[model samples]
Target: MKRIIITCCLLLGVTLISFAQKRVLVEAESFKDIGGWVIDQQSFDVLYSSYLMAHGMGKPVEDARTTVDFSEGGKYHVWVRTKDWAPFPTGPGEFQLSINEKPLEDSFGVSGSADWDWYYGGQVDMKKGENTLVAEDLTGFNGRFDAIYFSTEEGDVPTNDNEALLAFRKEMLNLTENAKDVGQFDLVVVGGGMAGTCAAISGARMGLKVALIQNRPVLGGNNSSEIRVHLMGRVDQNHNAKLGRIVRELDNGDPGNGNPDADRYGDERKLQIVRAEPNISLHLNTHVYEVEMDGNTIKAVIGRDIATNQEYRFEGVYFSDCTGDGTLGYLAGAEYRMGRESRAETGESLAPEEPDDFTLGTSNLWASLEREEPSDFPETPWAIQFSEEYHIDDHKADWQWETGFGNFNTIYEAEEIRDHNLRAIFGNWSYLKNEMPEKYSHHELAWVAYIGGKRESRRLMGDHVLTQMDIQDGVMYPDGSVTATWTIDLHFPDAENSKYFEGEEFFAGTKHIKVQPYTIPYRCLYSRNIDNLYMAGRDISTTHVAFGSTRVMRTCGMMGEAVGYAAYVARKNNASPREVYTLHLNEFMDIIESPLSIHNLPTLPQD
Candidate 1:
């Protein structure tokens, strides 16, 4: 009997493998006519794949259409991989699946399943040739799904278990197990925000072959058209005057955050500058989730194309973790810290008494425009309920329209943070339009940012963790380069906003601690343990209070410029990031002091 059972199991495995072609998987992001759906890849590091989100403010968007050609299709079971973003009872993101213009009876994204899981849409008899699939959005409030599955056999469905799901997706989509090599580079910068963009351009100008990778299609992170954050801090005050040149060139001179004019942020200017550099290879819409470590150093980093599901391997001598969450450093086993530090430990006056999980929150800003006539907005019962006394009486959502403070982590719970902001935005708008129509009757909703502008998450540890004392006293290290000019602006929950909503406050308040411009050391730009790794932007080594000043975009850009010059010095002497400071400080400083020239970089440092 045992022998017979083993034979049956072996035959079953072979049968399953042989009939794998009977099922087909269609990724939602790959749909030819996306229409009104937006590709959201922010949480791809955790979710493992990019999904489509309906980002309509309060109205249902146009249907997303795609065609599938099956080999003589008969009856196929339809399964949709989706999630209920907000489930007070029922979710707001209710959508449907339609085959050949006929809608399915089952509704998806409203199943009250918070996590990403599969939903059965019943069996349908498909035609032998091409069948058009339409994703119909019932609500305009962030309805999202990863993929759709069609199978010929019964009782055979995809698994929701992350590990098993990956294998299933690979088999169904024929995704490659081995990553294709993308050639060797002197530096691989894994972000294309202000910091990473400057790092790539500076390195290329200094004669280093560079690879700049960005998860989004655009170049800027917070300042992109998607997020609409204006450039801050004085780029001119840097100790190295040349360090700010690249930042100035990219600044679009937008006066405020969440501006309705997307062109005011200069997305094209950033992309054009990066493309002009012959030595830099910019890979947009690529998310890096894995890294190969050779002892303490990174051997190679593997990235996946968000829409296409193609994988590539990048090998480099040195790497930078500008991925604000310290994603690359965390994967490479580098030391990092999240949340606030204790006053006793760091000896900073601004720190909390005890080390707690209270970190700065994220912002999903929105804007509105004044119209001649009143515009209708749907009353959202699924959204967070707002009262006249509790709601913010404002025309536009700003940086203060933030969430995910206290226990909420900006990295792990990023999706929740963004969703919470969405609820607040819609609820406030509804109350203003429905309850008090006289004030905002002429105003219509403009652009609402789906990408959350994160303030703090994981701060990578370095040899020197710049504290409040360092910025306050102006402690000057020998390798001090970028001059941070922004005020020490630490953000927390607003007093009134928190009074109504305790743990999840959408509004923010900050107490600015004014300080003189301070020079930041190069030691804070590289990892302490990871020999070949460098860092910039918000992930750079800084205590919670000190980061308030250095976390601004212009300051982060200067840090990137310093890192680029340091990389050039390191390459000449065959040294790590630390050696560039300890062994070749003078040469690096000389390069920093010189004016930045796009075509004419100063001669090589003496051998």
Candidate 2:
């Protein structure tokens, strides 16, 4: 027994010596051409996948990529060290190190710091072997690594695991563990677009606690200064023609002329006026992540701040999907359809012969100003393909540059189409400015919009799907109505490519049909299956052709007002949205009528 004990002690000493010798010594010399090392073919694949995941709001790359492979498990001391001098901005400012996809906790007795003259770094994580390590750039700027080494010795690494470093990484995750619960509100509007803004303000005016969540810094979705699309609707002073009184009132009686040629004031200034309302709690730069539902009814909404990634929950009796994209409706399992409807199905003349027919294309608009100076613009190498044969000299635009006819099926792919159109816009602009004659030289590109204006997306399936026939026949539902002034205009898919600019005729077959300012049914606002949820904007129930007329922002804003008031009534009565649609139709109409009078506008047609 004594001999066996002595033999076991000797073997333990040998194992310790072997583990000590396995240390990885990364030094300054190992960092030569660091970019080449980190961005190799294998690393490129990893990076590409990481970007896709991040953009999709999926799991972090480190969680997906890190793997542990160990033949034996034991407590092995591990440390990472970078070169004293880095290729780029090195030290604490350039790189952030994380363990197990999380930053090392100070409670774990980790340490780190930036070296004064060289790169900054300190020791962290006295973790066991086979642990995953990740280095990220905390500074918005990219960093180039020089060298990194790992050693297994207590005093070998620089120790500086202070509270500040721990807090820095802790804040990145933005965990709400320490945040006090603020309870919930009565109504939560998931978008700050035109419809959403109206929904929150109108609901709040009804004395409900309303929370307005806007993903962007500003309100007014498409009409936002960021996108630059003008609000289009009728004014009430024209004898019930005022389709966008909500926005106009917010704009302080700023008249919105329906003509595209008119100088329409943007929606942001109006949004500011709405933001000052007492009952609305505006949460800007917050995006809705998910909707928590109880059966068919939504109980609460989960949102996240884009800057801090801190999550927030809002409990409410009712919710409105004014995101324009119908995000909330989609999340709540509401039935929706995208693309064109077959003419046979809707029994309308404008409907496509087949369901596969092209829908409206997105536009990447750029405003051009006539310049007097002899401007020297750089010629785009891709612009050589464009020639004068394509009517490049005819400066007038009737939506000719709108591309993406054959590419995507739904407007959700607007970004992809916008990228294609942006290339074309920039390429064409370069030729016009550089190659065109002096007579055409005055036109200079002024501004390109931040995002392309989307024409269509997941239209929520409502109790009544407004067909193209409804518009052509000027059918009025018994419930209520919102008026739109735009004609049933459809643009050809290949307008730019056709011999006559792809047979691209604006306001093609139908002239502006003067109907009696028909009312849109309340059934068309809320989703068919979802109990307490409502949808507004371009994504409401409508056939492809009907949408072309009703999808205008002015009509959308009216739809928002109607549905918003309905939601308030539903909350007050402790009833579902459908109940309000059926039993309290007059109350809904009264709300729309009363607000117009308060703004000193004419009453809408009751018939």
Candidate 3:
């Protein structure tokens, strides 16, 4: 009987392998039509592809449909890689998987792990030719679906390991190893935020061929219409006045977040500026994930379109990692640090005597519009629970509605942080509309940011790490080109909110320490080990305590300007970033003082 059991197990394994050989996998992001759904790249590293996210708007969204070529006919088992969403018994975010216009017997997206896992969709009959697959969302309560698998054998399942999953995807899809060459440039800016947009524009104006790669469809990272973060901090300063003319051109004239319309963030104006530049090639919705490293220098960076899965390789002499998260620099093996430092390590008062994972959280800002009639919100049973004792009753949500501090690593656990914020937003909004309808009778949730605005993560180590001492004493380097005007505005979990939510506090408390407007040295902008890499934005070399002041968008934008000028000087003289700082500081300074070429500065309204 034991020998028979072993023989049967071997036969079953052989059958599973045979079935797996003929399986077909469809990447959700590569779907032909993704209506009312958006690509969620927060879990790209963990998941096979960027998944489709349905923002919690109550009503069911349009389905994502794609055509697939099947090699064999007959019944095939359908599997969807998704999550149960809330981890509770009642999962509000449930969706159905349909094939060839027929709905599957079992409902998908209602069960799985915190990370992605597969849910079986029963078996469906299919023709040998072309077939259509649809992700029909039942409730638009932020249900996510990564990819779908169809196999002739029920036992053939895809592995969850990153390498195995990636290899399976490539082999099944017959993807090419060589990435499609996009173009060559003097500089390739990885982000399209305030810093990256400024860097691209500045480089183009300085007569360098530039490639601006933005992960989103629009520019202005945190300040974009998608995220809708109001640009803060000062730009009109002593050393950085020349660095912000381009930033001024892109400002939407809007003062704060919670704007009714996304257009108030000025997506068009930013796009127009980048497009007007003859030398800058702007590739929006392209996410850079891989880097080609040659020794200590980077040769090319590879990116994929989030909409279509087409990969592109961008070659450049110099690279600017304005990706706030230090994405490119990290990919190229650049030294970096995350979280707080010990007092013994940095010797700063703000440094937590012992190191801790306590970085500022990302914000999923929201707002409401008041109407004459009562507005009804659907019950969010799967969302976080907020009682009368602990509920938020605000008409507008802004940067303060934050989470992820010490709860998780901001980069590795980004999806968890964003989902936690979403749960809080939906839960609180539901409470307002349902529990306290009298007070919120006329208020309707107008806009909730699907893309959370991130504050800090992965500061790339550079030749010089700016500290709070530098800001306090107004230390100036010969290569000091940008002035940081924001005070030491560090954030911690709100004590009041923590009492109710403990480790899951969404609101933030800021402690501001005033400091003189200090000049930021250029040495903090380039990687110490990576030769050709330059960094801007929040990821610039800085102690966690000092990042409080320099992490603001305007300060980061000026940092981008400095990076652009440095890139030009490095390329013109055939020198590295370090050489441009040490050997040719004066020539770089000349460029900083003589900028005003790219875009016309908008006139500020008099107070």
| Backbone clash pairs in model 1 (N, Cα, C under 3 Å; residues 3+ apart or in different chains), count | 0
lDDT of each: 0.84, 0.54, 0.82
Highest lDDT scorer: 1
| The candidate that achieves the highest TM-score relative to the unseen native structure | 1
TM agreement with the true structure for every prediction: 0.94, 0.66, 0.94
Expressed as tens digits, the lDDT of each residue in 1-607 for candidate 1 is 0000000011111112224457777888777788899999887765667889999887889999888766666888888899999887878898988999999888899887788888888998878767888998888889999988888777777888765676666666655447778999889999888999988888888888889999999998998998888888897766677778888888878659988888988999899989988999999988888888888999888887777667778899999999899999998989999889999999998999999888889999999999988887888787888996777788798889989777577887888999999989998999888888889899999999999999999999998899999999988888888999888999989999888888879899998888888898889999999999999999999998899999999888888888888888898788999998888989988888884576686454553
Residue range 1-607, candidate 3, lDDT tens digits? 0000000011111111223456777777777888878888866644536878877567678987777766577887878888877776656678887889988888866664565787788888978877888888888887888788878889878887765777666665555667788888899999999999999888778788899999889899888877888888787875746778777787878658767688888889889888988888989888888888889999998887776666788999999999999989888999999999999998788888899888999998888889988878887777888888888878888778998788877887788888788889989999988998778989987778878789989999999999988989898888788888898988889998899889888899997899888988899999999999999999999999999999999888888888988988888788999999889989888878876454543221222
Answer with 1 or 2, whichever has the higher lDDT: 1
RMSD of 3: 7.3
Q: How many backbone clashes does candidate 3 have?
A: 1
Give residue 348's error in model 1 in angstroms: 1.0
Provide the clashing-pair count of each candidate structure: 0, 19, 1
Rank the candidate models, highest TM-score first. Answer: 1, 3, 2
lDDT of 2: 0.54
